[model samples]
Target: MNTVQLERMKNDKGFIAALDQSGGSTPKALANYGIAQDAYKDEAEMFQLVHEMRTRIMKSTAFTKEKILAAILFENTMDLKVDGQYSADYLWETKGIVPILKVDKGLADLENGVQLMKPIPNLETLLARAQERHIFGTKMRSVIKEVNEAGIKAIVKQQFEIAKVIIAAGFVPIIEPEVDIHTVNKQAAEDILKKELIEQLKSLTPDQKVMFKLTIPEVDSFYEVLADHPNVVRVVALSGGYSREEANSKLSRNRKLIASFSRALTEGLNANQSDAEFDQMIGQSIQSIYEASIQP
Candidate 1:
């Protein structure tokens, strides 16, 4: 890990709003706003809608720099322009918000809930592109379905293995291992996750640090160990499909694990709203999430 870059990321810790919806998720989001299937038949046209969606979100610029430390963007967004300037540069220059890139492809089917990221043959090239765009970090995701000890170990090991590559490329890696909230053994799964994460961090070289975006655990302090670990730069929580209010409530119970929410952060926003209304909804969301992250 590059200590300088890792420390830079640690210094910017706060709520990270995730705008990294994939091709699969984009259609679902557009549909929620009453967008018809005929609205955009092709992938290229759909990408424009995604760009519009992000532009609409950016109208709430007043809240971006203050409440959000960074924005996690999809690959398509990395090269997008706003007012003739690149979106990443616009965010930093106009709103003081750092930009992070989501590097993983969508999930692959593994066992029931265990997920592996879809392979990205050009990951190194992607990281190089992110650097060129001045993005500050990168995030990738995996999932855990149940509390099988062996499965948890394998997941943690693989995440760290990828993190090594990310760190070597001079970017902070947000390693996400989402534990499905519906799992019956939620607490047990978190316990295993905590142990495995700590053991893996112990095995890493001293400078190899990674950020975490975990589901809010059943036990509030289940991740407290990593939150304080030297090899961990930051520990943030994923909303994991929770309602905004629900996510805020759960996240408030934990110290150090702040918000890095996706769905919950965009809840209640719709394409039909006027610019003022849209800004109001998103601004309110940033406020709620920001407050939850700093709760002591």
Candidate 2:
């Protein structure tokens, strides 16, 4: 396992050890402390705790909440609530729970419950659905262009509708369009942004504010065009197509730039400042950036 995973495992081990020290034999007590009992020792409790954690995670996100829940309930038999009478239950109550506890909670839930549980819209399930639907690399870029051309409002509406279905199924739907900037040169990307995206932004209504996944090259031109539009409310720039490492590097290097831009837009919206208020906001951003840069 990687360092992070190892650390998490260590933490989980610590939690389990603490629970053992607490003198509780019931599964609920172990669960409240985020401890997974060995499957052979307490199968029913292990399964139940896994179900509850999955449910909790799913409810907390915009996407993947519903589907994950459904998957857990239907595919994994997660919601069946074993009566603590079956052989599996005795095994789990005894020694069968270790494997269940060691694996990643989410993956274990999916693997164990997916087959028996009916698909539902919940946060964890929806995230799994998103992973299934994620069109990456070249395919993602093409879809972004298609979505932009079709109109962001339309795309937003469609995505929201999908999210609704995902939610209805008991999963939270995370509906972010993947943008692949790595496949195209900067000039080609700029052309797409200026020619296609600018026109789309000009057409948006004030009520349709949603976060968008877009690259930096696209941001400069798109913002420049949007600067003239009175209806556009806010913009959040995303490092689309960047790997986790690259995204992290960019975030560390330009934390101030990112924070300042976000703060300016947020303050402007909160104060109902207009495009004409750009000068004042820009001045505020300079100060915010400087302060953010100096923070330890």
Candidate 3:
């Protein structure tokens, strides 16, 4: 791992920007940004349009290292450019924000009440490309819809199993096992998950380090133990499905867990806004999220 990036990630005060919406989620992400399905006719055009939107965000003066510790990028975006530079390189070199690639193919069909990541057969090749671009780390996600201890264990286990490979490849891994916010027994599931994660952390060697991107727990700071774990670099909260205001409110309560929000972070942005309007909007979003990320 790059020691400068590692040091920044270990003690950075700002939140991560999740700009990694994938193939399955792109339509929804575009729709939320005021682009309809009819706006782009095919996958190629759709990706092109979304890339434009991302370029706008990245090139904005508002998007900088002071308020953004890092950004999680899609594979498509990783291969593309921003203002004449590779997306990852632009983020780190020009803006001082670490760039991370989302490496999971997608989620598998639910089994045992959980959704594991689809196989990433090309992860080794992907990591090599990322390394060449000065990328710092990788993130992969799976989901838990309800409380099933066996299923939850499977999710965490899968995350770590892949994380070890990522570690060996010399990159940090941000393992995200998202718990559905709508689950009636969400707290119960988180409790079981907390225990399983502790067991996994205890098993790691001192040199191993990983970051976690998790849902804002039902109770404030419920994952403090995980946050404080020596093997962990930082603990970040996913907004899940909350509105931006609601996400920020909940995030402030967690204190230690910084934001790695997708929808919530880009809730009001639109492709139609003028440059001045766009910058102001993103600036406000960054400020709100930064405040919550560093909340005491």
Whole-model Cα lDDT of every candidate shown, in order: 0.82, 0.30, 0.92
Instruction: Write one digit per residue (lDDT tens) for candidate 2, span 159-246.
Output: 4444344334422222333334543454453454445445444444453322222344433333334423443222223444343334
Error of 1 at 38 (Å): 2.2
Highest-lDDT candidate: 3
- For model 3, residues 107-221, the per-residue Cα lDDT tens digits are 9999988999999997899899988888899999999997899999999999999999999999999999999999779999999989999999887899999999999999999
Q: Who is ahead in TM-score, 1 or 2?
A: 1
**Which has the better TM-score: candidate 1, or candidate 3?**
3
> Which is the leading candidate under TM-score?
3
lDDT for each residue of candidate 1 in 63-180, tens digit (9 for 90 to 100)? 5666788788899998998777788877777777778889988788876447767777888999988888888888999888877878778788888888889889988889998898
TM-score each candidate.
Answer: 0.94, 0.29, 0.98
Q: Considering only N, C-alpha and C atoms within 3 Å, which residue pairs clash in candidate 3?
A: none
Q: What is the lDDT of residue 95 in candidate 1?
A: 74
After best superposition, candidate 2 residue 217: deviation in angstroms?
A: 2.6
The true-versus-predicted C-alpha distance at residue 159 of model 3, in Å, is 0.5
**Number of the candidate with higher lDDT, 1 or 2:** 1
The number of clashing residue pairs in model 3 is 0
> What C-alpha RMSD separates each model from the true structure?
2.0, 19.9, 0.8
